[model samples]
Target: MRTEKEYVQWLMSVPRVGYLRCRKLLEQFGSAEAVWEAPAQELLQVPSVTRNVAEEILVSRQSYSFQEQADFLKRTGIRVLHKKDPEYPLFLLQIHDPPHILYVKGEFTLLDDKAIGVVGTRTPTNYGVLVTKNLCTELASAGVTIVSGLARGIDAIAHEAALQAGGTTIAVLAGGVENIYPPQNSSLARRICKQGLLISEFPPLASAHPGMFPVRNRIISGLSRAILVVEAARKSGSLITADQALEQCRDVFAVPGPITSPLSQGTNDLIREGAKIITGVADIWEEYPDWQANYSHKMKDEAFQLNPEERQLLETIGYGGVHLDHLIRVSQLSQGEVYRLLLEMELKGLVKQLPGQMYMRSSV
Candidate 1:
């Protein structure tokens, strides 16, 4: 006998059946198994269930193999999460049309709740790349899980930076988690699975189509507390994510760029339209003071002891690399005082000095 979830999976596999349709059927029948067993007339009674869709559901059920689906998931180590499942993302659930089923290929944890979505043009300029790397690296180091669509340019850079920072990230795919689109990103997808997650609403083998991308953008914003656009054209898909973020009541952030660049048009417009302007991770943290508190609590939980001045300096440094000049200016400490604190923190393995007089929090 198939489980109720297996029946839901079967319903999902039927042609013309989508998240909303599946939801309607399940709500009317009370269970996916009931929907599976529903007759043509009964299925048709559900709102938006046409005769053709009803027929498809019935016919597909006869041919669908629950055993095969189960075996495939088990073999590939994919996990399924329904909206009702407690393990499903809490933030995602707050959105209006959350995915009915999430196909996960990696670890998902509560830490992901502190996520920020980073997206931009598929073909980014050098300046865009620099901004993405610096911001994402810092955000991840600060324990903010970076979320993106796993596209070619900025998305890939964001994921790579997060991993390099030894932080978590999530890639929301337009296609199946197993069927990585833009095949070049296959290796990056694998890396993300080890450190974060690769998730989709589609099944493991579902191929991507053009229409799937906009649909996928909602999940990106839905999972994040805020969405950041590093670079985008006047008409770019990254803008769609930002729009969805606003609709979902999630914060929208944009990195300002040169006015002359077409790629910056979207982001600059966002800044003009009331989206937060982010120059660095400090700008992001200013929006979420609770995150700072959480970081401090986390440090205390790990038993890392520090005096008031040391704590203040560490907070100023944040998780990302900060220039010594910026540190001294922000902390309002004298040059000698900042240097002494940095040296002490470095020796204690709480911070590391990078070249160019930059400092960042150490993993310890």
Candidate 2:
């Protein structure tokens, strides 16, 4: 017997049955199986279900096999979460145009609560990179799951930082969960699937195009409790995510950068327009005191688990931040080895690299 999820998946495949129409049908018929078995005349009775949509639904059901779709999901380790499913993202359900089904890879349960989205320009400045790494690492260390678009630059940095901190993250894609866009982030995507999740609205193997990102942006913001804009130009896609977040009534935080920098334009504007100014994780912690408390012990435990070399290195840095040369000198390591180990530690989320090649122990 086909599951209700399979039936919803089949209904989603029908032509002209986009999210709104599908929702209307579901409300009318009570279940996807009932909707699928309903006659064309009855389908037409549902609000906004025109003759064309009703006829298309009837015709499409005869051609598309639910078994085939289920088989594909099983083969690829993909799961379809219907809107009514208990495991479906609660934040997403409150959005205006929530997708009827989410094609997901990896841990869907990670999205149940406590996520923050990090978004910015594809070509971020060094300042953006540093800020994204520090904030994401701190938040992840504090038990907050980072959410992002899985794009290059800031998004990639956010996901990597979260993973390095041994925290959960979610990559919301514009394409199919099976198809990683940009091709360059394939390895990162695989790594994310192991510790976090990869989610999409498109079905398996569906190619992503320019038009899909706006819709994808909504899901990115929808899945999170807040959105952080690290760096964005006046017309960046990160701004779109921020706008979507505001519409969803989620808090938006912007990192203030040098006013002279081109990359800071959007975030600066956001600050001017009353978005919260974020200097560190404390700004976020003020809003999520409970989350901060929950992860404090975990962060300290992870910190204590570091090896002798790492612990020594971390001790040398202290809380005030140390220059790279000082860090190497104090740790008694070669310059090359210091850089290599620092990078490794940065990925492990034990350290944060600041501007001017300085390093600091993570504040978590």
Candidate 3:
């Protein structure tokens, strides 16, 4: 039985025998040991295990040593999460094609239900960078886990901002967790390993290839409750992530930018096609109200006794709400006055509180 488990790991390490086929092979043969013991002709009987694949399996098993693979994993401090492992991400199992094995290189826990994926282009405008950082920071501060592809632009910004906010983040890589593509972000990758997790379906030493990212993008979306595209060109890989998110039945949020900006075209197109426009975190909470229960607002008895200045403050908050500092800036009020007024408004039920000292008009 122990050897069979090791054989299962070995089978996963074989190239060209991807997740779906591996799953089918296991179901048909009952175990990796059974599959290995079967003659090539019998292996061919399994659906989708073509003659070539069966032959490849038989030939490869001759040289594949489970002990060597296990030793390397131990030496590198990498851990494997087999499909049947109790600790395998539950959300991933719900996706159409979950990887049979995940090579994780960091502290990893099954994510909280409030994870949101943030992704975008490799190059972004100044506005895109600023908004991605600010939005991710606020979301992280609110106890939401940020998930991203760990690519160069918005994805890297999201991960950094989440860490900066002293919150957990997960980086799902296009290559191996150990490879750390783009190389420049290797330092950031090391930081993520300490504070969050670095996960990949690829083997520990696999370098990223052009075709790998689209496959990887699905995991980014599958692991989250929603996906936010901070910015993307019309033909960006971020759009591919959005499509995968929709296919996974996850909500998609796109930040609006100037209409004429090339970076905004993809997001604007998403909005026109019915994706939610993310002006603030409140917009996200409105879609998943259950996720917002911990941050729900309550009315205080003294709230009804608001002064004229409080009403002006409440109106300035708008529907999606503004951050406390942002409110003070636009309202031209002192920080103390805005904080006092916001507390009063919250008590009255005229406004609601959000994570990170943000407020919005009360729909009730």
Candidate 4:
């Protein structure tokens, strides 16, 4: 067997055979080598095969030797992963646009782990840097792998924090496996290769370009269970990733900030639309009870599960601890119903009633 990786390299050499086209052909033909060996007339029989694409596959098959391609890959450090490989990301395979092959560099195990994407503006404010570090550190300690683009600001801070906390992270780049954009993160990229994973969908030696980023966002969300936007302007590229994550049916979380901060606009808007409002580590920890199983004593040490009506009352408090009157207005469950739910949830460790009867999400 020419192994799927070798076959994918052959398929990639064929001009105009993009991710989707390659996937479709493989599903129809059964294998990349099968498609390559199929006569041009036979190849065109598969759906969506362009007249030019079919011809290019024929020409390239005869001229491009597998050994030459292997040599090229070695020189550029691009290791290809085919769908059949055990190393392929399990979550990515579930997505509609799964890459036929991922051109990866650095450690591959990070792809197989449970990861959460931490994204935000490229030029982060001081607050963005602090939040990015704190949350990633918390998440990492709780046994979640961090995922992010290797761009500047918040992304860099998130990656660094994961490493600093003695945890692994993954950087899904918009360029080739050998390329790191924003240029300045070269040292950080090197550290990630040593401790985490750095990957891309493009071939080795391919330069990073503007349009490739939107395509790159899918991989970020595709690799994560949820995405946490640390800070974004109204028009940040992080918003693009958030939208893609929603379409991919992943949870979206945003930290609330002061209204006076311009960088808070996107996050505040996300909260208004009912995205999960995140304040501290517990808000995220409770959302994934599976983590509780392995969570250090600090996380599982004090936790409780709430019933439906009680859970509704707890949500009324929101992330930042809403006051009693405001929480009642927002919940709309009436005082009697609210009081009962609150009492049950508070005893269950889901919420705490402050001095003024305001409720807050419990940390313990």
Q: What are the lDDT scores of the predictions, listed in order?
A: 0.84, 0.85, 0.80, 0.79
Task: Please list the residue runs of candidate 3 whose C-alpha ends up more than 4 Å from where it truly belongs after superposition.
Answer: 3-5, 18-31, 41-56, 110-113, 293-364
- Which is better, 3 or 4, measured by lDDT? 3
Give me the candidate number with maximum TM-score.
1
lDDT of 3 by residue, 1-364 (tens): 3565477777766666755667888888888888778898888887888878887888878988777988998998888887688888899888888777788877778353469999998898877887787677656765788999889999899999889877789999888888999899999999999888899887777788887899889999988999999888899999999999999999899988789899999999999999998766667767877756644332222213457787678778889868888888877889987876675455334577889888888774
How many residue pairs clash in each candidate at the backbone level? 0, 1, 2, 0
Model 1 lDDT per residue over 177-218, tens place: 999998999999999999999999887888888888999999
For candidate 4, what's the RMSD? Answer: 9.4
Which ranges of candidate 2 are over 4 A from the true structure?
Answer: 1-4, 14-59, 294-364
Query: So what's the TM-score on candidate 3?
Result: 0.76
Model 3 residue 155 CA deviation in Å: 0.9
For residue 344, what is the lDDT in candidate 1?
Answer: 54
Tens-digit lDDT track of model 4 for 1-364: 5676777777865667765678788888888778867888888887889899898888887787888878877886667887778889999988778777788777787787888999998777766776777678767766789999998888899999889877889998877766678789989998998888888877665677887788888999999999999788898898899999999999999988779988889999999988798766667777888875655535422333345655566666765777777766777768877765665454334566677766787766
| lDDT of model 3 at position 266 | 96
* Model 3 CA lDDT for position 301: 20
Query: TM-score of each candidate?
Result: 0.78, 0.75, 0.76, 0.74
Q: Kindly report which residue stretches of model 4 are placed more than 4 angstroms away from their true locations once superposed.
A: 13-17, 20-30, 38-59, 72-78, 293-363
Candidate 1, residue 226: the lDDT equals 96
lDDT of 2 by residue, 169-202 (tens): 9999988888899799999999999999999877
